[model samples]
Target: MPVTDIITDEKNLTLTVIADFAHPVSRVWRAYADPRQLERFWGPPTYPATFTEWDHRVGGRALYHMNGPAGEKSYARWDFVEIEPERSFTVDDLFTDEHGDPAPGMPVMRMRFAFEATDQGTRMTTTSDFASLEALQTVLEMGVVEGTRLAMGQIDAVLAGLREWFAGKGTRMEVLTDTLVRVTRAIAAPRSVIWRAQTDPVLIRQWMLGPDGWSMTICEVTTEVGRSSHFGWAPDPGVEGEPFGFDDQLLFLDEPFRIVTAGRMTGVEGPTVTNDLTLTEEDGVTLLTTVMEFPDAATRDMILGTGMVDGMEMSYARLENLLLTRPVV
Candidate 1:
């Protein structure tokens, strides 16, 4: 577990927290730089934070809201004053309205984050200065310390996820040309296991769900090179609409390592897309890469506009969890 220490100086109207992460500086730095990663640990676990706007450079601003368990939300904003890459950054933090404008009668704080590399890992120190001791005391009464501690405690899990992604063992997305999108991830499962998960309808149904409340209504896979497969997804219950899915013809197959397919999305106006999937094993981990080529940039952009990147990230995350928890027979 990482160690988090909090210190306060009423006279100086400052609160400081020091913590160490068992990850390299770059890996730890990403928790603050990446908006999606920041959302995972920015607030107490119960009140998850979502950033609607994020810009981390100097003079940039961020607008976010923390959603409480009881359908409540607290909006906030940050004005970045300075940023030093993987080293340090300073920001002005303040309470904001739902529209991201600063809230009246709210105390503002200047916060600084410093990161240093150590033999064990990266050490991070955060200091927040209030305009007056009263402001500091007020926030303390609001359980700031404990809430912050709980939030920071989640960094370890984020660091682990980032390590896999950044260490060449996690998913990477690239846009090759205007019509192609490539995604790759490294899994800590055997090639055979991963191959089965891709081709076996039973296993596919477990990891192929689009998002929460979405389920696969149909899944069929044929390992033969000339055969075809089909999969479909239905939205959450009570939704009024037909399910959407895809039908694909397997063009190539290389046992447990490679597969190529040409598929068309059902109930959607789009050109047929070609999918190329490859798997490689190194040590005990297997790396999976997927390439999707569309007929035109317009089609690709239309799909990208539908939060495809975030959806894919969530889907891959669920797959990773499944691989870790499900017993492989």
Candidate 2:
């Protein structure tokens, strides 16, 4: 686990938490940018959070609720003030009502999250400036300090999951004939679990998303060869892009080892892409290698420019979280 250091300044009425992650700064940044990933570790383990609103851009707002063990809920909101991608962001946070409005007499906290690249990995420093010393003390009395420590402690597990999606230090990207791209990741879970998560609709929906607030509106899978699998994503409200998805035909299935699918992006102009997914086990971990062949180099380059790689990495990180926390059936 990473060391979490907390600092309190009574004179300035502020609190700061500094922690190190074994993953890169970009990977740590996604944990805050993606709402679904944020919700997984935002609150204490006993009080998990559900984010109803999330916008990572400046001037945006986020609304969420933390559900306690007895079913009680505490609502909160963050008003984004500044945002620098993969570096830092500032927000004004406050307790809110169930209707998404700020509650009266609640302490308003100005918070900043800074991500810095380091030799060990990424160092994440979070500082919270309270309205006054009294306000800071009030939160401290409510166990905010301990709860925050517990919540931040979960990042280690989150990073562990993300590391598996990154393909480790030797991840190499080669353009074979300019039409094929191969990406590999070594996952800690067994091959069977990874296969099930890829083929089962229920499990697929858990992790196959671009970011938070986006949802899979349709996920239907047929494992048998020659059958078709359909997946669709509905973007969050006010987002610019059209709902995008894929329609895939299962061409090959080798149980918990390999699967080959020929698919096309729905509502997009592109030739069919054949995806070859292979999984192998070493010791107790599984190595997943995926090869995607596009119809042409132009099409491949065009897709690459659309930030699809970042989205895929975020999705894979979510998948790692699911595999780590979900019960095996």
Candidate 3:
């Protein structure tokens, strides 16, 4: 039950995480070196993980598959550089293809993990080295620190449960089997007023463009379950952006009450994404919730890095403002 601290060396472009656990050396070591254990905590809370080619020996390698909320998948790799049983190990970690082919950039990571004997358990120090300060900044700016911490916290719970089971005690550990981001926003208007803004292109033009730096380029609807629709976005204020639009399959709907759509972000050709939008009414207020399921952790991380959340937040703000300005019809 020791503390954990994540540190950054701005000059050397290094990140360090120090943690302690009540588990023995063997248990803690397995948690990091075992593929099954590693897979249980590799990605964010939202997705299930799969690992392959995991050989935890010196010079051996491994690949992992991260399945995202939308059923899309991304891959990562690790080449073990050094391994000392129950003590420490070092590896190169990065995004890669299933065959261990490196991805688009030289975003290589040198990771060193050391375990020291402590009074009751073990102290683990994990450090990562990047190519440059810019690369380190890039990951941090992409919310890697927060995301990794959340994943590791899940690991901690698993380890704790193992300890409890070993001590002949009942361990009730909860692994987040699934997580959905349900966004809820209230518009102080009748359900029909909000529905009009959602359905009427004229009313959509008033607020859906999202002010500046965001514009909806395409909006298509089929109004059927197997049928599909598309909506595109552009950064330009007025002009439509190229390749901006979604190809969405209508999954379910309860009219102005609920909607479930599956679609991908419009691209020439790549992975597909699915999103669900739900609408509800409460005491003369309209609530809208959007839940997007990504294909994998890499895609999700990439989308987050690309500032999608900021745009969504701004769009929500504009909708709220527009609703306030327009009188109830």
Candidate 4:
């Protein structure tokens, strides 16, 4: 197991657990920040967990449940009290019922997870603060320590699994809901570098081309919210295809991590669509996920049938190749 120390302080009404991993701080933080990755090892092997709803920001709450071998389930919720990206986060953990309401007569524990760089890699320090000594004793007596130790031991596999899942996989698309779709790709670079390649006008022109016979005729991108950005593409000489473009305005921005945009085709008459993009790094590779929302199921099916994912695969492959030889831009 990666855990190096586990301490209990009755006087302070706290339990501190320290674990070490052979990965960067940012990668470990990403594992926790991403719900898909976090669900892998959040519970014991006999009781795997599944998160139904996850709101990752402060004041947000997450609802999850663990399924036992005998078809039994245990529910829990986390109220995000504070978040500091790669450094730390604090959450109030408590038991909850199916309807997302708190269970009566249960102890709520406030857990702070701190991550810092270490000589080997990263050190994770988790401190659980109890409201009273009785609370601390109650949890200890209920086997929290053993369950946590088993849970922490399983995260290494999750981290390793993530590394294997995305490598060499091209742009992947999935239908998330009746009116929503998600596209994902993993690039062999850091989040900051990927963000720059997607945003910088000069770099965008180099690899934003969707197909072999096309060129970026115009590239205008902005990080400022409410500002419109435009991108246009034209076929090379003797190449076949109509010139196309998209005009979009930033709806929300969280620099280098997430962005939301609303946009429509340049000259086509259609309903505008909303896109939410998120980036997270694991083991030096950045995973880019974009969720697109359409007005209705008809719009969703019509657009997807247009080979949108193929164009995205071509563009993303170009971006990956461009990054390999990129100078400090």
Candidate 5:
């Protein structure tokens, strides 16, 4: 993993990253501006990755979703803040519920991507700002550094592949997603392990979620509550597959108490749905209840018809079983 500068703050935490590539400014710019290109380079590329809702215009919205390892899933959104063709772009990254409302325990992530011409090609720089020191530390502890490093590497590979294609050697492929998949696991392990699995992006990549053939390129935590983090997962090179994806924002996160989130299906980008997951002790077994509330009749029908809720239940069951069978040593 490439090391990026990790800047600390007494009040505000910030992260700055810079990378140079051997590609023209226009090509580099297209990789960032085009959603289709984005799907190829972002996140865990090995997992099935898709860009469900992409509005690259300024003031527009972008959303994405992906299936995860061990029956885990993820979704997110962003609002474009500024755009300047090939020079710079900015966005306010946040976690929204299914209704597009902000959620708790997540912090606001303001990011700016700048492209500058260089002797070799173009130098791309990314700067991420957080609200406070605690938020920064929280995110660091949650595994932003490693995740970001992996994601940047994938971006580099994508650019390289694009260049090769321009040289008359690569074949272009189309990305697709037929249906949304939700995986649930039932684990008997203590809630602490479960918490680690949920909070730490590293562990999340290990087992939580990844599309069919892609890997998690980036997973960073930006806040504790009412904030949003940035996660990048993309398709692995030469892999053609789709992971069930969603576009959700975290609504509530109470540590081991419960978690609530809302978002829409990533494959179709339809109505939003809210999910409430509660972890309670039942006869020494953790009773995990995941209830998904749809915003409209259409969404409810979609959830039911797709069997995503059932999939979620099965995933939860697997998690519970894993926790129970393996003693937390």
Candidate 6:
């Protein structure tokens, strides 16, 4: 949220976003050069952007699509016009169709990006030039200023090292959008070991239990895509609570790295949420990131209000302890 100035000039037919950050110019520039990092905050928290093609050189165009919570996509193409590493760059940004072709009737905006070093750190200025006042107004009405502010607010987390920023934070949850939420936790375990602890039914039963008073009654796992996994838990002997389970269909599986699933409460009828779980390891610590897409904002809030993150923190802590005492084979 370091935005200092948001300017709209009717005579110039342009809009600009200016922000300052406490980082070197080189470091701030890499955030845009790397697609993996760029996608982290390019769009608003709600509609996350995914780059399908990345070519940063002049005459090359980058293609990306922002995914909406309800399975909608808004595609964009960026044609690089100029490049001066760590100094300045320009691009002709356009709304595009699924095929990356310019969508008819969409106004193309010429964007200039400038980076400069300051006493505190770095400053970034982005200016968008439109063909006419009407074109500028069109994007203004699209909530471009607010969305850019919120998106830029995420730059701090991206600038900090993952371990430095998130370690010891138990569990972190962010409402990305009305129907999408992101959760993250850092585990002091290797990537493969953590993956096995999650997917192996035998290991799962050991630490997947929510709390001290619960026991995993059912631990069914499926490693293959297009399969189903089921998990159930019940109160331990003498404990007072109802048994519950989750039914999940595996849609995508990348061993030791990522998995995507459609999950719903077992025996309960409604919509199935899409969960994308990814693990990245740094310095022997695995960062667990889960992006959950719910059916609606209400459904998202309901589950979060149920102490879901608290339960997850308990399970993750148990998993960490189990890993320490009983190292994976």
Candidate No. with top lDDT: 6
CA deviation > 4 Å runs, candidate 1: 162-329
- Winner on lDDT between 2 and 6 is 6
Query: After superposition on all CA atoms, what RMSD does each candidate show versus the true structure?
Result: 16.5, 20.0, 15.4, 13.2, 20.5, 3.8
Off by over 4 Å in 4: 1-161, 327-329
User: Candidate 6: deviation at residue 126, Å?
Assistant: 1.8
Models 1 onward score TM values of 0.52, 0.51, 0.51, 0.57, 0.47, 0.78
What lDDT does each candidate get? 0.79, 0.78, 0.67, 0.84, 0.58, 0.86
- Candidate 2, residues 42-157: lDDT per residue as tens digits? 98654668899888788899999986533468999999999999999999989999988889988999999999999989998999999889889988888887778657755664
Once superposed on the true structure, which residue ranges of model 2 sit more than 4 Å away at CA? 162-329
Top-TM-score candidate index:
6
* Model 1 residue 145 CA deviation in Å: 0.7
TM-score of 6: 0.78
Give the runs in model 6 whose Cα sits over 4 Å from its true position. 1-12, 43-55, 65-75, 96-101, 132-154, 176-179, 190-193, 222-228, 249-262, 269-274, 281-283, 293-301, 325-329
Candidate 4 local lDDT, 1-329, one digit each (tens): 78889999998999999999988998899999988789766875445578999999999999999865334678999999999999999999999898879999888999999999999889999999999988899889988887787667658746665457677778988675577676889888889998888788988888888879998888989888879899999999999989999998888776786677888999878888887776767787788877788999999999899999999999899898888876434
Q: What C-alpha lDDT, on a 0 to 100 scale, does residue 297 get in candidate 6?
A: 94
> 256-284, model 3: which lDDT tens digit per residue?
74456676667657566555554445455
Tell me the number of clashing residue pairs for each predicted model. 0, 0, 11, 0, 67, 0
- lDDT by residue (tens digit), candidate 5, 264-286: 64556467665555443322334
Give the deviation of candidate 5 from the true structure as CA RMSD: 20.5
**Candidate 2: clashing pairs of residues:** none
